[model samples]
Target: MKTPNAACPCWSGLAYEKCCQPLHKGGEAPTPEVLMRSRYSAYKLGLVDYIMKTTHPDGPRFQADTAAWKHDIEAFSKHTHFAGLQILSASEDKVMFRATLFANSQDVSYTEISVFRQHNGHWKYFSGAHLDP
Candidate 1:
């Protein structure tokens, strides 16, 4: 668990309270890049509800089985180490990032370009294409 003054898990250099905390506490992200960073932080913090709520309902990643989906997310969050995040590029509706991660002492890092869509004027994660899979 992180204190309010600790650095954010998003690699944004800002305090958690100044950065992703607002997003996790029901504040809307103003841009796709911000949303993407916040999502990474949410995973680090095991905020399952935030991840589910920010996922686009019609997107490919959106599973109908909420219980199973939440369980999977929780399991992943528990096992994985969120090492770092680097934004490679970002457009109005897309963000490319390199997620540095480790699980079971094995490197599971990957570069992914993610798509976002506006749902009720707030950004929602739509899909992701791994560039290094």
Candidate 2:
């Protein structure tokens, strides 16, 4: 759990309030990379509603069972350690990054290129393609 003044969980080098809080508080992320970093911070903070709201409904990863999906996300967030994030690249709609993590003291880090799409007027997480670490 991080306070508003604590370092951002996204490893953005900015405090939580200055970095992800605004986005969590209904501000829109201007780009996919920003949204992805905020999503990582959301995961670290266990902000499940933000995760749910930011996921693209039309994307393949959008789970229809809201209750189950929220539960799964909560479980993961509680059990996993969000160790670090490294942005590899960013285009107009895709952001590639490596998320270093640990679960049950076992390393579970991964690199991923996340895709985003604009739905209505806001950018939403669409999908992710995992890469070998």
Candidate 3:
């Protein structure tokens, strides 16, 4: 877990408390790109509950195994290190970004285009497609 004063995992150049922490704590993200960044931060911090809560109910990625999901999230967060994030694009309810992650002392980067939906004035992750780039 990241301390409140640590640099944000999203590489936003802001303290966690001033950046993604509020989103993790229930504050609404104003844009899909912001939500994507907050979700990446959530993964780095092992905030599975926040991840689940921010996921849209109708999203294809929704899973019923809360315990197993939390366990998996914790394991990944403990074993992997978040390196950085790069926002490629943001349009309407979609965002494209690349995340740099390290595991077993090796770098692993991936990009994805994520879709978001606004529900009751809050943006939630709806789904995503991994990009080949």
Q: What's the residue-level lDDT of 111 in candidate 1?
A: 97
Please tell me which model should have the higher lDDT, number 1 or number 2.
1
Candidate that scores best on lDDT:
1
Give one digit per residue, the lDDT tens place, for model 1 in 16-131.
99999999999999999999999999999999999999999989999999999999999999999999999999999999999999999999999999999988888999999999
Candidate 1's error at 50, in angstroms? 0.4
What lDDT tens digits, residue by residue, belong to model 3 across residues 35-123? 99998988888888888888888898767887887787779888988999999999999998988989999987789899999877799
Range of the 10 consecutive residues with the lowest summed lDDT in candidate 1: 124-133
lDDT of 2: 0.95
The Cα error of candidate 3 at residue 57, in Å, is: 1.6
List runs of model 1 lying over 4 Å from the truth. none
Q: Write the per-residue lDDT of candidate 2 for residues 1-133, one digit (tens) a residue.
A: 6778999999999999999999999999999999999999999989999999999999987999999999999999999999999999999999999999999999999999999999998999999999975
Per-residue lDDT value at 30 in model 3: 92
Could you tell which candidate, 1 or 3, scores higher by TM-score?
1
For each candidate in the order shown, give its overall lDDT on alpha carbons. Answer: 0.96, 0.95, 0.89
Global local distance difference test of model 1: 0.96
Candidate 3 residue pairs in clash (backbone atoms < 3 Å): none
- Candidate 2 — which pairs collide? none
- Alpha-carbon error at 93 in model 1, in Å? 0.4
